[model samples]
Target: MKVIKLDAIDSTNDFLKALASQDELDNFTVVTAENQTKGKGQMGSKWQSESGKNLIMSALVKDFLYNNEQVFNLSIVVSLAVIETLKSFDIPNLCIKWPNDIMSYNKKIGGILIENTLKSDGRIVSVVGLGLNVNQTNFTELPHASSLAVITGNTFDKDILPALIIEKIQEKIGLWETNSTDFWKQYFNTLFKKGIPMPFKNGAGQNFMGIIQGVSSIGKIQILLEDDSVSEFDIKEVQMLY
Candidate 1:
């Protein structure tokens, strides 16, 4: 539970990854920054946040996944952890967009990017980076983005939110080992737009209609197509056009 607070950094994930390479980091070791000069999102998207107004942090997780194939399970655990934390604050309509986008009222509020490294000894360690919109409200240029303050009309203490989220993560990390069936069930339940027909765009920018049935064990989204055939798609292959 060692927490390092920084005034600003290029990226908390990069900082934590560098720190782990030089020294031994305990499980759940955390690095948080007030501002990230080069914050990143899924697929190289930029994560923009006003200084001191959001929660930008990374946590080190070791000895979690038994093998590389179980990597998506870690994503499920972390995504559910953030969703549960926000639910505690009574954030209305909180749901996780497939593969780790935190949403509220169909608006984007946060996201997760996980980087896993396999050690020479075959151990996998992950740096889980999270960016949550907390108090920042100005998203005029980014129409789909909104903060907790904007949604609830009340500012939140960024300091407290990360602690709660980490605590929630710690509580659920063991579920992967104990009860994976129930673990996946919880994640699917919180999945945004599940079981609903929606429009999706492919990598080639072709639009099609499908329903999100669930995710594969390897993390691909399983979509029920218009022809009643279920198809699996990698994250890069499909984008929800809601």
Candidate 2:
């Protein structure tokens, strides 16, 4: 997997797709930009990344192992990859929020966004994009936002960190694909909350108090609600809110 660094790009995902469309992108090829002018977030929200302060990169992946709704799990892989990478820095007290957000001290340090581009034959061509706040101090006033430097008090950020993170990503992806239980256990350990019952909302706006039972192979999360009943949801079907 060759990682391509750019001085600036509008969006790594867009760049990768343009290349993929021209048959230029290979699986595991990475495109990272110093700044993304039009970076996107969940639900078309603008991803606010100050220039040269965070990781704005996209990875090309051809995951044909998914069926129907399960295809979105690449974001999960990318999220877990980011979490593992941060841990390599010995950054303490970091946690993985439900779905795809990583946090430190209850504030989000970074996130993953995965987009799928298809071939004419219906094969899945995914561009997993990560916007992890790395070397930065202040950001536009957002409560759930932070950076690696801000969290770990490190003076340096992206220069030496991206390579380390890429290595961790490869390791995590391999482990997650082979041993699902081990992946779940390790992911659960870094969860913001696991055993304790907490209030959560789903996509339908219904609320429930439940324990996050971690991720399932189906990519749905198991929620053991206060009623002693268990329910499962895919991605945005459940949103954990404190």
Candidate 3:
């Protein structure tokens, strides 16, 4: 798990995609940038960063590591990995919002982006990119953002951030290697809501309030409503309101 550190780049994920196009690469190969000029997030949303104060990195994983069914679970696995890693740094009260946002004290501190590519050999490659706020203190203009330093009131050494995150990713990634109950349990425990009615807009542009029941094995968010009937949503099929 060696990180190919960069002074700056457009997008680490794009850089690694080019590497995948050029030649064979090893799994767990990380490409991190000091600053990203054109970073994209889920739904092709922009992933903005404050250059040196944040963690901007992406990992290229080979097909043998995961498949379609496993890919959805991987998001939960990776998100949990990040949440646990931040906790290890003494950043408590960390919670994972549905899909891939890390929230603390009701504010966002990090985000994860997962991309899938198919190879000519009938295998899938997952490129997982992560953007975590680590040491910045001036996000007042960026309202929805906060840094680890702000929450913990201590600065993080950027030099070792990527490696530590990658190590945690590998550990959580291994949970998929076996049918570990803790994987799902950890994800569920960190779930955004237990039984309270949460406002959400489905992918179809419909707004509804449904109590989040837990994520299904198929990765769809299972929402239990006031009617006692359950409605399941595929990934990206539902979005929670701020």
Candidate 4:
């Protein structure tokens, strides 16, 4: 991993993406910031963090060679990596909220934002941006957000956590080339709210209760509604209601 440590920046993902546009970056090339002025999240949301107190990093995933259909698997890999890293720190009740939110005890502790570069035929080269709440213990406005320090009652070395997560991510990238069956199985097993009934809101803003089944290979969520009918949804099609 070629690591670039920045004191402050607008966004690590944007920085790495700009570098990738200029030239081919090595696989696992990383850019991390102590402070991000405008940190981005999925669906154009903002990721909030206290300066120098969390993990704000982006990694280059070159030559992944996955088609558009398999893009979500990349998300699965990154999310699982964060989960695995936190578990080693003994964070309790770790779970992955669908479409890449990492949660513990029903509160979000981490999230992933992935940007992709597609070839002429539409295969991908990914930029995986990760934000994990590490030592920060204050989240006054973010009612559902928590951190490793908050959950465990112990302050952690923020710098060390990112390196550990990157190492785990590298292991998952090795699986991308072959035998992804095990990774997929682990993903489903760690999925949050799996087999539980919960309220959800669809794209139309309609609300209903549904049981979490499993996600499809391409990343569509499968849910069994109250009427015993099955429905599959893309990320934008539905959202889990807390």
- Estimate, for each residue in 38-103, the C-alpha lDDT of model 4 and write its tens digit: 999977899999998998999998666567787888888888888888888899999988878999
Candidate No. with top lDDT: 1
What's the lDDT of the predicted structure labeled candidate 3?
0.81
lDDT of 2: 0.76
Candidate 2 off by > 4 Å: 63-73, 174-177
Stretches of model 1 off by over 4 angstroms after superposition: none
**Cα-based TM-score, every candidate:** 0.98, 0.86, 0.92, 0.96
C-alpha RMSD between model 1 and the true structure: 0.9
Task: List per-prediction Cα lDDT, in the order shown.
Answer: 0.93, 0.76, 0.81, 0.89
Query: In model 4, which runs have C-alpha deviations exceeding 4 angstroms?
Result: 120-123
Compute the lDDT for candidate 1: 0.93
Candidate 2 C-alpha lDDT tens digits along 1-242: 68889988888989988888887666688889998999987767788888887878888877543554656456555666777777777767788776677888788887777888656776878887888888877866877788878877885657666667667666766776676566666666877887878888889898878997766766678888777888888765777787
Candidate 3 residue runs with Cα over 4 Å from true position: 63-66
Q: Write the per-residue lDDT of candidate 3 for residues 1-242, one digit (tens) a residue.
A: 76799988999999998887787888889998889999987778888888888899898877444456666777876898788778788887888877778988777889898888877776888888999888878886778788899998899886776777778777766656684577888888887665679888988898888898888876778998768899998766888876
Clashing pairs in 4: none
| Residue-level error in angstroms, candidate 2, position 233 | 2.6
lDDT of 1 by residue, 1-242 (tens): 78999999999999999999999989999999999999999989999999999999999999887688889988999999998888888999998999999999889999999999999999999999999999998999999899999999999988987789889888888655687789899899989999998999999999999999999999999999999999999989999988
For residue 138, what is the lDDT in candidate 1?
95
Winner on lDDT (1 vs 4): 1
